[model samples]
Target: MHDHARGLSSGAHRRPLAVSLALTAAVFAVQVAGAILTGSLALLADAAHMMTDAAALVVALFASTVAARPADERRTYGYQRAEVLGALVNGVVLIVLCVWIAVEAVGRLSAEAEAEIAGGWMLAVAAAGLVANLVAAWLLRHAQKQSMNVRGAYLEVLGDLLGSVAVIVASAVILLTGWTRADAIASLAIAVFIVPRAIGLLREVFSVLAESAPRGTAVADIRAHILGAPGVRDVHDVHVWQLTRGAPVFTAHVVVDREVLDGGGAAALLTNLQECLADHFDVAHSTFQFEAVGHEDRHNAHR
Candidate 1:
């Protein structure tokens, strides 16, 4: 049996996300100017990704706020899924941004004409961007653990953080060795780092959109456990899924012995079944349709 239950931590996700958004917006402004002045493709790429990060963070913040509203009659589950949609949108933006960066880096690498970069300007702006990314990482670190919306934001900032480091290294290289190719190389490397993480995020977002069962949860195991409860003869139509990150919900048709139904033990049996899911599977929200063994099979029955 699981000893402790898990729940969404409230009011904290927004703080870090909002702080990160402000910092990212500031860095993007500086980096765009730096990119133009320094003529560094790597700086330009990092700045571009930061643009997406800022936009994505705004969506995530809005979703988190909307997700907190209580469920109403017209919208039974409320707006909790706003976070999921935000995550999907963020993932799509990351992929599109990555592709653009990759294309530009390839063009730069293949160009015949070479351009001299202002390494000093590139390095200064990149360092500042790196610092901002670090601050963003620290602020959002805890929130990412329980919230997919925050995790999407965290991953974007993390990718930009790595992009900043790559820009700084390229700038330093060009400063010392006159290696203009380092700029393109660093941009390509940044794309490399971003693609895989973006793919992973898209997979998770797609899972939620598809309404698939939460990863690592076995429906067969859950069925067997339900059947093991006292007076339970069968369990069917067992469905388990996450309403969101850290929240698992279950529903099933549980058939019981007719004697148990007639003997006034149905309430106790229902409690046992609900507890089974709660204690063993960490499924706090469960609904079981209990019926006598023969009742469910009686197709001739009328309402």
Candidate 2:
């Protein structure tokens, strides 16, 4: 059932990402031409924004493919981390793009330059971008609910949609008030929206890569649960980490009653403990070291 669900999600995500990439590429080209023809900062900013959308879709497609690869000896955890890496890359790229846009906007603001604003073309291109991005956003919304990687891509498209709106409003203001500064202001607004979101995503991806404990799964609670099991005398060396976005793994040293080890009873005790952990804590993977009562000193010395 899980495999079937995963296959469906993979298929669903790929189609939208491909379509988004193609549309973003086309929009980027047109926006670039518009920017050059009218020397409009707002149009150029939107073009840059579309460029990042194209790159993000490409990353999403590649990462999704890599993440589907089965586990092997070389990568026992499977390729799930590929998606996190891709998200990190996308976030970094967005931050860099934001910086570039901010720099250009600042330069234009300093010069107080007036662009040959083509209000009609700017409005039309932005409207097209808004519609296309909305469609792309809707297509990925369902898939995003199931996967962090897909959610990252969805956020990127949503950001682009907002950029499109900003460009549309800026173009309107420029046409009405002849305030070329509106174009620079719109670019700055786009940068404001993009930078913090990228930073937040980068932090999340880095946490996963650092093998931080899974969210909402505290070490102290896990320790208490393990020690509360029957026949468990003490627990130490407890470690927990996320194996993927949702899967978690745990390992610990458990001291068991000496009698449980005699008469071949230790295996049954371990089995019961494993079941308890899984049922109570949602730990999918666990490694327990069974130790007899008198062996604590010897085990400690060996370690």
lDDT of 2 by residue, 20-126 (tens): 78888888888888888777787788888888888888888898888877779999767777778878878888888898999998988898446567777887888
Ten-residue region with minimum lDDT total, candidate 2: 1-10
User: In angstroms, how far off is 222's CA in candidate 1?
Assistant: 0.7
Q: How much is the lDDT of residue 218 in candidate 2?
A: 81
For residues 173-215, write the lDDT of model 1, one tens digit per residue.
9999998889999999998998899899889878877777888
Candidates in order have lDDT scores of 0.84, 0.77
| List of clashing residue pairs for candidate 1 | none
Q: What's the residue-level lDDT of 25 in candidate 2? A: 87
Model 1: residue 88 alpha-carbon error in angstroms = 0.9
Q: Please list the residue runs of candidate 1 whose C-alpha ends up more than 4 Å from where it truly belongs after superposition.
A: 1-12, 297-303
- Over 4 Å off in model 2, which ranges? 1-12, 145-148, 258-284, 296-303
